[model samples]
Target: MNIVSQEHQKSGQQPTEQVTYAAPYVDIEPAESGYVLRAEMPGVNRNGIQITVEDGNLVLVGQQQPLSVSGEALHRETRQLSYRRVYELDPSIDADRISARIDQGILTVNLQKAENLKPRRITLE
Candidate 1:
């Protein structure tokens, strides 16, 4: 994931036109062994996307180009969009083993469970 400093908008400041981009949808699920995070980021390529983990936080960034139409345009009404989402990862996640892949317009991130976080069977004395 790309690391970007958060832009703080001043209070009462007029919203910028660039904020109209579509926000990606994300779903987080807990499995028997780990956590799965799926994000919907259509119209984005591998080069346009970035994912990074820093200070126990997972960050996702990407850009999407708006559809272009040329020649004899009578009516056009689609806007271009892009977005970013940052998640504060829990300590139970094994950050070093995290993996991600994009398929069918969905970005899937798997957070492996830390060795210490996994359940262990103990024998009674």
Candidate 2:
């Protein structure tokens, strides 16, 4: 019958394809003293993230794993995500003083400005 043939065709179809998402949701703000960067990375822990400064470029690399589920269902969707971002640092930034922390699924990176970069008071002679 037509119904039986349609059911067989549907069953023959392949499962849903997996997808990988890259991290691009980052916010950069310039404060009076330094620069702050906030990155949104859910389901990622501090151990999975890596930050490094090399050759005047700041790089952020991390991976996000898919959630696990129990019980079999009619349909399912799961995917792994990874991201890497490179930022060119300004000469005024003190790379040695840069620090980063992650809290509640948000990663914050603070880049301190060198003492020379700070505004200095100018007095007339």
Model 2: lDDT to the true structure: 0.73
Candidate-wise lDDT, in order: 0.75, 0.73
lDDT of 2 by residue, 44-81 (tens): 77887899988898887666755676888677553346
Q: What is the TM-score of each candidate against the true structure?
A: 0.71, 0.69
Candidate 2's clash total is: 0
What would the TM-score be for candidate 1 when compared with the true structure?
Answer: 0.71
Error of 1 at 14 (Å): 18
- Candidate 2 matches the true fold with a TM-score of 0.69
Would you list the clashing residue pairs of candidate 1?
Answer: 1-50, 1-51, 1-52
The reply for model 1, stretches above 4 Å from the true place, is: 1-22, 65-68, 71-79
Q: Compared with the true structure, what per-residue lDDT tens digits does model 1 show for residues 1-125? A: 32333534634555554343455788999976788999988777676778899777888876775556667868755334565888999888888998888876688889889998788998999
Query: Which of the numbered candidates is closest to the native, going by highest TM-score?
Result: 1
